[model samples]
Target chain A: MFTLLLVLLFIPFIGAFVTAPLQQRKADVAAVIMAGAVMLAAISAIIWAGGGRFDYSLAGLPWLTVPFPLFGIQVDPLSSLMLLAITVVGFLIVLYSAGYMSELNKEHPTQAEKDRYYFFTLLFVGAMTGLVLSRNFFQIFLFWELTTLCSWGLISHKRSSVAVQAGFKAMVITAGAGLFFIAALLIMYVKTGSFEFSALGQLPPTLRLTAVIFLLIGAWGKSAQLPFSSWLPTAMEAPTPASAYLHAAAMVKAGVYLTARTIISSQAVPAQAGYLMGGLAVATMFFGLILYFFQDDLKRLLAFSTIAHLGYMFLGMSLGVAGSRLALQGGLLHLINHAFTKTLLFLAVGAISCATGTRSIKALSGLGRKMPVTAAAFIIGALSISGVPPFNIFWSKFFIIAGAIQLNSAWGWTVGLLAIVESLAGFAWFLAVVHRVFFGPASPAAAAAADPPPVMLIPLLVLMVLSLLSPVFGLAIITRIMGG
Target chain B: MYLLNCLWLAFAILLAGSVLCLVSKRHKVNGPLAMISMAAAGLLAVFVAVQVWLNGPVTAGIDSLSIAGFPAVPVFTVDRLSALFLGLIGILSMASVLYTQGYLPHYKSEDPRRYYPPFLLFVLCMMAVVTVADLFYFLFFWEFMTLTSYFLVVYQRDNKKNLEAGFLYFFMTHVTSAGLILVTILFSGWTGSLSFTAIPEIYRQRPPPTRPC
Candidate 1:
């Protein structure tokens, strides 16, 4: 089973190696094949993980080991869930890209450009896979930086000046944040003589707090939380699939994943620390909502919404520290639900924009008629995200509130109040969006628009229906994730 | 326990009556539905108040549902303090819902049924805030109350001034809610418990959290 994990993590890297040299049109086909392979590997890994936890260190392999001998991989219910999400969503985005890249920026893309795009996309798949499976923070950070590089590459693939700038901003912000994470890891190494997560408890209380603060800085930067979140909206200048693939599905989740792993593995989380995290989360969520209200660009609006939901996840995870297992479950579940909902939204919007040649909410209306399938996917995504009941995001949001209600602390109540306000605001915002953009008479651009090919629609439909039904399955997985 | 059950019964009646208002095609049916629900809730509120006044603060709470060993907020906590407010609000709500029978024609909105949801939501949040024992739930319901009021104000956003008023109303309520949040935070910090019942013990302590920081 451990060897199965290794194979799953390496499969995408091998695919990228084989994919990079292929010709343009063939590369798209090859990439889809690779994506299918990756998805299958992830499903198998999920099954293998259910039997038991896996903690395999590369330290025994003399040639494969890093200088610090801290390279390794691990899997639990949480990692398995992340693996399932990244690969499944990753494959869909790649398949969508196959249809999407047909006409790039008004010109048919060259073979070299297509190959290059798939190369980086496939590399991202492998790196994110290795990232979640890796046990050691050192290996995780290495894979983490690899993903940043991959996203930067994909974001700039169009070679437009705006694309270049967006890529640069993403790289600079995430790498800068990564520096804080590295510093925290270094401090842990100095204190405990090890870089593994299990050694995180050896530090004294003050050092533990210091490491937590720095780790949170890194997480916030990576996740595009407030104050460091501007890069995410700008990164929307990339192709929509890239935005869906990197920003929504894979890279952005790394932050919350790190935060969850950190708090859960730590010896004990002090109450005041939970308060500190809760306060940051509230501020971040507020910023995300305020940003969301003003976004004219569709992707940027999704970006702001993404940032806001990241804060909600952190808030739940923080409450988890105060001994609210419901919060932990909700936070993790939200993380997964956001991944699916957000990616579906981005991909559907991407298809709409590709067909209509516009991504502005104002420029596009009455799309529900001609592009009913895409419209349905978009509406479902929006409703799920806004915490509407009978939708996937709603259950997680409810559980998060339940966690806050359980916390019953001053910090808990404050977060609970803000969560309610934000959820209500989201409901109104997305509902108004649906009414304006989809329900009204078709604008000229929307009138000319057609639904995306079945290649894209199938994935969207599958994800939409699966997400709608996820709440029932989520209960069992959440309990398993809590390590019971 | 009987007092608590009576209070819950009143809540159920009000909520059920609000849902029943949806079935009516005419104002005649809906207005009386509203009145009946409010009147039933008011009667129950009066009963709760009398019981609390005579018994000197009877508390009823449930602690069965928890997360990670942290107990959940009590479903409802109706001591003398909360019971008094519930009774007063119930009386006010009954009068207001009755007044809506005649006043329904004056408000310039189609489907006057829209008013009742936010109105009932407002009343429910108010009752919930007072009746909740823990600080967390109190703040949550406080914000809910504030939000429902904002919605009610903006429901008639036919004019620029109405929108402006809604915005201002939202801003002011959040400021007050922020203050309430801060107060609860400081109270929990000093008292080490968020239960309203613990305030007296904190105040009676020898030092009484004298640092004030």
Candidate 2:
């Protein structure tokens, strides 16, 4: 088990170094294989655990033990589930890029930077996997900062003036917010003499509240939940697959996962802290939903959708901290479900641009007949994201709403009611976009468009079925988690 | 175990046919292979599902391969719920694979490699997902079914958009699968076993939460 954990952790880092020197073709193949290997190792770890937890730490990490066991791995059901999502999604993205970054690509037709793209992408995957498995605050922080570095590299992969500025802006905001994370770590260490996640529970009342607030700021920034939300949309300047991975599966998820993990590890978190989180999260959710009306670019619209979904997660987590296990389960499930849905939306847009040479909702129409697979995939994604039934998000969102109602307070009712309003409004807007872009009569751009290659279509079809079936498994897991 | 025998036989035919599809160079040959395998499997699935529906559940134990650490675990148990889903899979798999026979002629530029193999494997996985009694194997086949369908969705490799669509499709499915997997673990943790057989006894012993309403 320990050996498998080590392999899972090191394989991507090894791939990053190995792929850096290889030519483009070799690098792409190697990176995909490497990601595939990481995914296999993660699965092996799951089988090895056999429904139990594994906590493996090196006894001889002498210098690294200043405040914590920074070099250990903790593979509970939570971390294992996260590891699977990260590695599996990472592998698919790399496979997609093998075709997506080629000269055949109509959206951005150049094979100029495959090595760099694979290098940073692999590093980002590694960092996310590591972050999920980290047993201590310092370890999580290291992986956390590594993710910020990788996003900077990936977001600016094209190095256009706009891309560079967007990348710089993302780095400045996230890394700046990361300072508060480390500061919180410092506070925990000073007050409790440990950097274990549980140390937050040991801090005195005043400092504990302060640390929680500081951590929330870090989560907000990384997740791009309002006030820190601006960078995500601009970060859309990155290549589509990178946007899909970073925004959907990796970077943004890191924020909420951290918050959820912290809450899970700590005890007796204050009611006020939960209220602050719930309040900011609801505001962010509403704020993101309102901005959906303004987006012309498909990616920007999806970006706002991501922001709103992240807010949903924060709301769920806050409710969990306030004593609703169902909400926590739903929040975690949403993290996984939204990754697939939002990534599908982003990549669908990528496919649109690849075929039609434009992502402008106003510039494209009647693409359904031409690009049937993409159109179908997009429709599924849109409906699923808007909380339609039998799709993935609907189930998680249902639990979250139920959780709010279960809270049964004035605050809960208000947030639950507002969430319902947001869901309906989001459905309306997404359906509008779908009708205009896919269902209308063909414009010139749509006339020339068609479904993508077998390489790309495979992932979309797989995701479509996943969207449909996710509720079955999502409910089972959440039910068991809540002991229902 | 007669139904179980038919199920295993169908699985073998599909697996063998898919391997042939991958290796065969001629589209004409691949089409017939896919059609034959899918038809045989679909008939078997429907027959087994009907048998289970009429005569109660079908149960079988694979002496060779049990879920790891749980040696007595049954590998195939088709209860009514599984039978219903299996029947659906049978109909859909037959219809889609048969449809592809007519569909393949239009895409002259495409390779048969992209479609027939994945289609067969997709069917096989779907069949396995419903038939497997262990939660782990159910999820494993469920995920495999998702993975194989991806190849079918992106049959047009030249259109970059299809590739993007495929990626998006895959990203969503793969991630959601992690949920079912987690549920399986939780089930095992609670029941001390990985088979569906353990579920009823555990639930009987411990009552489920009452719905608030």
All candidates' TM-scores? 0.70, 0.72
Q: Tell how far residue A380 is off in model 2, in angstroms.
A: 0.8
Q: How many Å off is the CA of B168 in candidate 1? A: 20
> lDDT for each of the candidates?
0.77, 0.81
Worst 10 contiguous positions by lDDT, candidate 2 chain A: A475-484
The stretch of ten residues in a row with the least summed lDDT in candidate 1 chain A is A103-112
Native-to-model Cα distance after best TM-score fit, residue A313 in candidate 2, in Å? 0.4
Per-residue accuracy of model 1 over A61-97 as CA lDDT, tens digit each: 4544333556667888778778877998889988888
Recovery fraction of native interface contacts for candidate 1 = 0.00
lDDT of 2 at A341: 79
TM-score, cand. 1 vs. native = 0.70
